[model samples]
Target: MMMNMFFYMGLVSLIVLTLNSKHLLLMLMSLEFLVVYIYFGLFIMMIYMNYEYYFGMIFLTMSVCEGTLGLSILVSLIRSYGNDYFQSFNILW
Candidate 1:
């Protein structure tokens, strides 16, 4: 029960962070928070249901890949433009 509450709170925080974020790094951090919350929630559900495996391992693997890709893009952008702000990447400019 407590774990579930924490998981929900984490999700809510993730949403709020995403909505309020103004930079790419902040957005990425919020996304990471969401992923962590999802993993925790899945763990709680598995424990309560006595499930041996939730097959969410694949989902986690994907998230890791996504994080790596996002970071790589961010690094490349920063190296090229000297900034990490998403608003700085103007397609017209």
Candidate 2:
């Protein structure tokens, strides 16, 4: 009960952190945190439900791929702009 509440609160806080962040790196980090939290939630659910997690495992793999892709993009952006701050990215305008 209390553990679930704390888990949900952490998720909400991670979402707020991602939304309120101004730096690309911070936002990306928050997104990664969100992914990890989701994975943990799914893991707990699987334990209690005692069910096969084919979809969950697939989703986790996809999430890991997505994170790595995002990191690669961030690397390129940093290389081009010399910083990970959104304000530093002027290619959009």
Candidate 3:
């Protein structure tokens, strides 16, 4: 129960940080934090449920793919804009 509370608090803080951040890099980092926290929760649930290892492996693979894609996008954005600030993104405008 105590561990769960800590996990929830960490998740909530990461969510708030992601929402409130003004820089794209920080947002991406927060997103990674969220993904990691979710994965951790899933792993714990899987262990309690006695689930198969393949499912966890698949989830890890997907998470890595997503994280890599996010990082690539971040690098491209930084190269194009010279900074990671959110306000500089005016594509929709």
Pairwise TM-score winner, candidates 1 and 3: 3
- Estimate the TM-score for candidate 3: 0.81
Candidate 3's C-alpha lDDT? 0.80
Residue runs of model 2 more than 4 Å from their true location after superposition = 1-5, 12-16
List the pairs of residues colliding in candidate 1.
Answer: none
Q: Write the per-residue lDDT of candidate 2 for residues 1-93, one digit (tens) a residue.
A: 969786786778677775766787788777777777778778778989998989798988899898999899999998998888887777855
lDDT score of model 2? 0.81
Total clashing pairs in model 3: 0
Better of 1 and 2 by lDDT: 2
Per-residue error for 86 in candidate 1, Å, reads 1.7
Ranking by TM-score: 3, 1, 2
Give the number of the best model, judged by lDDT. 2
lDDT (CA) per prediction: 0.79, 0.81, 0.80
14-82 per-residue lDDT for model 1 (tens digits): 776868655777777778878888887787788889987636787789899999998998898889889
Which sections of candidate 1 miss by over 4 Å?
1-8
Candidate 1 C-alpha error for residue 93, in Å = 11
RMSD after Cα superposition, model 1:
2.8
